[model samples]
Target: MPTTSTGSKSNPARHDMSVILVTGSYDHEIRFWEAWSGICSRTIARTGESGQVNRLAISNDKRFLGAAIHKKIHIYDIGSASSDPILVLDKHTNNVTSIAFNSEGQWLASGSEDSTIRIWDLRSPGNIVHRTYENGAPVNDVIVHPNQGELISCDQAGSIKQWELTDNLCSHELTPAGDVPIRSISLASDGSCLVAGNNKGQCYVWKVNDESTSLPRFQAVTRFLAHNKYLTRCLLSPDAKYLATCSADTTVKIWSISPGYDFKQEKILVGHQRWVWDCAFSADSAYLVTASSDHTARLWEMASGETVRQYNGHHKAAVCCALHDGAS
Candidate 1:
């Protein structure tokens, strides 16, 4: 069942059974908010060279949370009361841009400005790198396929690369937008569709074929102008019924997805004063939480297109958010 924010303090010690609504900001702090109440229930100080969080991901089991900082990652035990990170992963040579946990949460995949994608084995003694894939340009986003046998990544050079786990090779490459930075990518949970958002504020959709081979083929479905300014992130709802795109235009637009990958405008979430950087959908696809450079994060009710809650505690730009409501 989807967890509700009941105006109570977040019990980090009970994370596995509680709702998690976390946002990371340039203020050098990560804040956990009571989703519905908009209360900042917990805060953790982050200090480093960059002092800004680029991305955040919660393990599928809700046992751990990962924060991507400059050239490193901080992994936190969600059940712990300590404010310090349980493990610090320092492998990337440049800013780590993105991070994601596999379905089983046994490992984490990270993409970086270092031009590489690396998998960290959480089960290993020191959480060592399990595998690494080299890209020609700075990586922006990376995600694991639902089958856990492939990885897909997009880079600053606007190229999409698919790496096969068994062969340890890049099986396919596509450049939908030439030479422009592709900022984000989202794969449908069932692995049937892929969406990439670029600096030009355009989004490319593809139909994925993943059933027969280790390497999936992508067929161009459609391309559309998602925003007039840079598109920071594009995420497919967990239930695969909608797509959410946040941009430098200061708005988050929701698109309904239909058969054959047709998309129609659904809602325009407007409230942030600065760049809308990231967003995460609720497990049931009924709600969306967005982070913005305005130093706040807001929860939007999809059906009504209204801001249900506003989380305000950050002193600087809030760039990334992670939410796990235990319904997966």
Candidate 2:
């Protein structure tokens, strides 16, 4: 455990529904921020510089923080007295690219450079991986479906796999021609659409058949090109109303979607001086946080595309983050 590495003292007077915002960077440190005040409430030191934080995920109950680094995942008990990680989960032969949890927080799923996805039982003992799936290509991201029964994974080979946990089988697979390594993936809240962005900055969207129980189908919805630059990340707002994307072009843009899921560019957010790596919307989708190569995490007001507060602390590029508003 380490002392608060950067800012204000740890304040315990926040409301029960205080939003938790955690950002990790090339600095090898994870800092927790009070999103409203721009104060860093807690900082967890990452001693070994195996790699910068590639991604982060928070448990549903807000009891744990998961940080994905090179070949390893660190689980920090944010609710506990110590700032040190409570557990270390590792096994990947290369970088662990993405980390996420089931809606119930009963399982944690990781995607890795080793081309595998593993599900760990958080409540279990040593070596908690309860199930594993092999894709044979470096996995860039893994996202648990809102249904909580399927894991959607995209990999370097540009393959999309829907692993059905309840049935213990792969329910569907998509292998795009000239597969160009999909880098980011996002699923709509209603399980209505799925989107994946490739290294070429091309985004592919599909309509999902949520009612299907076996051999589900993803009909091609639409494909659009985000010019500017290569894609870094694409995220759908929690309410499923908008799609936000980050790119090497150094901009974060929002897209408006119709009731039928037709997407159109709504606005562009510009402030970061370098490549924008990731962005996540607040619980109400009224605020947005973006990580950038410019070494900052910015909070933005979505409506006016104005910067609300700039969280400045990371010594290096801020690459990824996790946010929870603590509301059901």
Candidate 3:
């Protein structure tokens, strides 16, 4: 027998009820937001002297959150009440700028101003740090190869280096120009393309070939000037349809990824009053989250170029963000 009700309200937010969004900034705190609402559901303190979260990464299983901080990577349980980290792995001497987990959650990689790239075996008893590879300059960005056992790192001295995890050495290096520091690096969804942005506001593109071999080759596909000011981050949508870039010019630009890595400018997102530091795409790539120096993080609808929600709890600039869509 069914109980009849006069009326029932529809729950539109149920689809993203379990989605997680963690925003970090210079305020020394990481705030987790409700997916559909602009409300901060949880806030955790994470910082040391001269250290705020420069980057954030979530494990593939969505069970752990990793924050890249000065000289260490703090691992926290996503569902825990305690603000204390479950693990603190320290090996870096300078501030950690980037951290990411492998697709299988077995390895964690980090790059830092310490001028080193390291991989940690998460399955080990202490999550032992592996062989340290020197980049000769402060590494600004790190990208894990989709092939599982490789890492591509870019440094402040304009070197794109590929490290072979099997041989524990650098197999190849790509230098577009001498001494132009690269700010960010991103890989296309199918692993066919690699793109990097530099402090000079130039973007470089390469078609990844022979990746299945021991020596992967990156052939330069295209190079273009992107922004008037420094580029902060370049990201490819998970769906492979768009490449999004944030810059010191205070804008996020979306570009279409056409054949042969030819990019066509699709839209320009404008709202932030200051530098745009970071951005993350929703699972469907229909929406984007942008962190800006204006002390806010915004959710934007891709089609209309309009902000749908503004997250406004950070005391200072929002520098980094990580979004996990549970329904995807």
Candidate 4:
């Protein structure tokens, strides 16, 4: 279990979980933290020649960590800490915004600002499995289906496209009638629904069916004006029972989604002095972690809407964060 700390600003950032990774805008470094003690574990500075680190993705086994910088993807071997990435993939023509590894750790997908998505095979060296494109907006986020070989991608146009990884073809396109650009996308663990957050501080839930046809269809289950400001990130609980969203409005909300996927606002967590940029849930769904422009990351109790602890050490804004259980 992770221990709670009650110290002042003099103390280092605590690491309650196994490993914590943070990406900063000004520093251009991906800093690792010891989860329970809030201590700086290691700092992986961008290679002497690379641009700022924009995003991060850890493999399912926790043996590898991927960082997106400029138009490249840097893969680091976290099994041993040398601060140097083992492989640097420079194929995207524009800034690589998001990357995700499938549950089996066999495939890796990267979404770029160039309006393209690339799928790479982990088993083969320098092998590109699939490459697909969306109409012409930066592909901001990409997520693989929980149980199938399909990929879901979202962009600045608030449209969702489904691509079949094996065939390297876009199977379907889902454009919600409105024009709010989607900032983030997340799929439930059971693969029953897909949730998207937009720039208008709204979240939309869609029921997805795989058995329907080649072009999978979606039905709008609910739409929530979650906050007064733009939404930055959204995540679904491990059990697919709740959806958590963070926004520029300086609040994080947890919404109940089970038994019919209703958008009942259960709790609104607040403490950050600036925009809440990112939020995540623990593996067991017992805790919530948030990264903000306030130069601090906070851990909150999911049920009580109380901030359990705060990790404040970054001199600048903590743009992105990832929680690693360190199973490997």
lDDT winner: 1
Q: What pairs collide in candidate 1?
A: none
lDDT per residue, candidate 1, 176-285, as tens digits?
Answer: 98889889999999989999999999999999985577654898989999899989999999999999999999999999999879989988999999999999988888
- How high is each candidate's TM-score? 0.94, 0.92, 0.92, 0.88
**Per-residue error (Å), model 3, residue 144:** 0.9
Model 1: ten consecutive residues of lowest lDDT: 7-16
Ten-residue region with minimum lDDT total, candidate 3: 1-10
Please tell me which model should have the higher lDDT, number 1 or number 3. Answer: 1
Question: Best candidate, TM-score-wise?
Answer: 1
lDDT of 1 at 91: 85
RMSD of each: 2.9, 4.2, 4.4, 3.9
Clashing residue pairs for model 3: none
Whole-model Cα lDDT of every candidate shown, in order? 0.89, 0.84, 0.86, 0.77
User: Which 10-residue window of candidate 2 scores lowest in summed lDDT?
Assistant: 1-10
Candidate 3 on 1-328: residue-level lDDT in tens? 0111133366343323357788999898889987556778788964454578789988768888899977889889887867888888898999999998888877799999999998887777775886688888999999888887788999999999989989999998988967899899998767888999999889999988875677548888898888989999999998888889999999999998888678999999999999999999877898899999998999888989998889999999999999877442
- Tens digit of lDDT per residue, candidate 4, span 1-328? 2534446689854434355444444457777765555566677765566576667777777777888878988888876668777777787889888888887677688899998888777767764544555547888889888875888988987788888767777777877735668888999888888998888887888888766567447777888788889898889988788889999988889998767878788998978888888776767777787888887877788879898777766777777777655354
- Show where candidate 1 strays beyond 4 Å: 5-17, 47-50, 211-216
Model 4, residue 249: C-alpha shift (Å): 1.3
